[model samples]
Target: MRFADIVIPDTSATRGALEVATAYCSPALLNHSVRAYLWAAAYAGMNGIAFDAELLYVSSMLHDIGLVKEFDSHTVPFEEAGGHLAWVFAAGAGWPVERRVRASEVIVRHMWDKVDLAEDPEGHLLELSTALDISGRRPEDFPAGLRAEVLERYPRLGLGEEFIACFRDQAERKPDSLAATFVRGGVADRIRANALDG
Candidate 1:
């Protein structure tokens, strides 16, 4: 789907924020972001998380606005980028600080499997959203240690052994790759934020 296809309820602030973000990044990623929003929404609904679908859509739509300002991993860590983006968009659009803060948090922690939700709500939500997006797919590119860690923490996630094997073998064979790990990490934190939030 085109980035333009991503719509948050009734042309809200998120729509304007996403328009600004699309001007900077590839539309392809925005498409993926839409998928992420769907995943998060479904997961939240199924698991009884008190999430607002429209708000989640809006947060996910503008989650990566930091890329618009050319913020890097080193200078603007992913955890902080979300909050920063919300603030920037809010400032640009004359939005309130509270709204900006919520959006910014979503962007900052969109990649958060390794984070603890008690400490970081935004990261947890992103993690949950990511996990739901790739629910049945195996991380065939994750390191052995990382795979073990995930399984240990979420044994009840019920991922099949075959899927785990596929991810482990592929990841081990293809060393020096960061795609699987980073992608998983992004969702991990979001999941925690969304699932573990009170």
Candidate 2:
């Protein structure tokens, strides 16, 4: 069960996210998302983290769904509504209640100075995913508004500074444990072999 094979694309959240992900952000955002979910689930499984794979997978896909709809426009929201704009998009998509709620929770909590770590564990996962998405490269390439949030929420994972470091180290040294590689290769091959490209 490769990561890409399970990514449901027809949902409202996903449709909006794909547009936002491809246009507002880099392709790597989409790539890293698949990687993050795979890595997080694998790690959880190996260490007994008791995570819901489906929840993590879907939550990860939609965690940044807010980003797609709220970039650079002042009236775009992310303001007094407490990011209600993003949640509205997710909710309006007709996603299952649990998935919508979880996705909304992660999205709303992603902004630092806004995140309540103790109350939102999925938010922490979202934070960790955000940080690991760009840890090895120039910090400038990261979303300017998101850096503080990353720093604030990442440490809460209790993986320490070494958390992302460890994942990076594993990816560098042990590619099998590296989820992104498998997902990309798998997705590409699936598209090709299954004639999914249209």
- Output the number of the TM-score-best candidate: 1
Q: What CA root-mean-square deviation does each model show from the true structure?
A: 12.2, 16.1
Residues 1-198 of candidate 2: C-alpha lDDT, one tens digit per residue: 233322343554555655645555334345555545644454344334454554455556544433333342233223213235445555666666766666656655543333444666556555554444433222333343343433333222222232333233434444543223433344323323321011
Q: Write the per-residue lDDT of candidate 1 for residues 1-198, one digit (tens) a residue.
A: 222232335555667756765676455445445545654544444445565454466667766543333642334343355566667766776757776666666655665545455654444556665554344332332333433433343332322232244334433434333324643445334333332121
* lDDT of candidate model 1 versus the reference: 0.49
**Model 1, position 169: C-alpha lDDT score:** 40
Total residue pair clashes for candidate 2: 0
TM-score of each: 0.53, 0.44
Report every candidate's CA lDDT: 0.49, 0.44
Residue 140 in model 2: lDDT: 39
- Given candidate 1, what's the lDDT at residue 173? 39
Best by lDDT: 1
